[model samples]
Target: MRITENLIFSTVLQLLEERPVSKITVTDIVRRCQINRNTFYYHFAGMEDLVQHLLQAKTKEFLGLKRRFRRPVTFLFYMMLVASKYKTVVLNLYHSDMRGALEATIESICHHYTHLYMASLQKMNLSDTDRELLIRYWKTIASGIFLDWLKHDMEYDMPHAIKRICFLMAGNKDLSSFDQLKN
Candidate 1:
């Protein structure tokens, strides 16, 4: 059952790379997977359900990673790198009705890592509200960067751009002296 589900999931992702989500139907998915509609429906309620499941599965996969980073910026970089691997799929979802699901996944990832980073700071004391606000702020910034990249068709050097943004956020006055974090 899991194997069939995975096959369906991968087929959808492959289809997404070729066309936008709006253009994809369950028939297309089942046809590509060589599965019947009953099998597809047994695993997914509809296209939206499949998309939500896909996003949730992706978020769980990312959260399951054992490698923990001391800095949230590093986590953000890693997340972006992973997303860049499926550029067309991401862009397709971003421009489709499923954009909210994609954004929620990004926010979930950002919040998880940001909270972990905050918890690692043993010397700092923050009120719950303040901590929430800080996480939200960083989440917004990270989401903005990602959406902006998609908006511009992802032509720029993401790593260098992220490093520069991190340096600026760190309050480094000399742009020429800014050094990328050795992660």
Candidate 2:
């Protein structure tokens, strides 16, 4: 966590705003970071190596959204925060050959969500297949909704939006069961 490493990472992300990843070089990072080649090599071997570190860090922060919270709205709010932080990077990765980056982010989000879903299912005594089915179903729907929401800037009250997402995975059960939740 050297300050210089953060500076280099931020600078690399910034440069990505105007060019493709393949076009970016270690010199560009060092130049933007106002550092020397040795400094860059001290913190990172090269652009590819630095990029992997950056991607993992960003994905880790995104997955950290799974902390204790009573409602799904908090996750949605976190999603908005994420979109705001890396709007251009997200849009670029979403459509660029960097599909692995986008997929990694989605998989982490889905994994955290699956944890929540599995906990609730455990309370209900769901079968393994049922739990997996629930996770798989929500993962697909939530991924698409997240992509659309980020792409279109869909606006809805947080509570209402969370309710809608719940209904999406209700699985023939009445989502009204959760409506009594404290807001």
Model number with the top lDDT: 1
Model 1 C-alpha lDDT per residue in residues 1-183, reported as the tens digit of each score: 989988988999999989999999999999999999999999999999999999988888889986688766678778878888999999999899998888888888888877777666656577888777767876777677877887777778878998777657456657434232212
Question: By summed lDDT, which 10 consecutive residues of candidate 1 come out lowest?
Answer: 174-183
RMSD of 2: 4.9
Candidate 1 regions with alpha-carbon error over 4 angstroms? 169-183
| Tens-digit per-residue lDDT, 107-181, candidate 2 | 667657655855654556778887677667656655666766655544435446756666654533565554433
Query: TM-scores for all candidates?
Result: 0.86, 0.67
Question: Candidate 1 — which pairs collide?
Answer: none
Question: Candidate 1, residue 25: CA error in Å?
Answer: 1.6
Instruction: Give the lDDT of residue 148 in candidate 1.
Output: 81
Model 2 alpha-carbon drift over 4 Å, by segment: 17-23, 42-45, 69-77, 148-183
Predict model 2's lDDT versus the native: 0.66
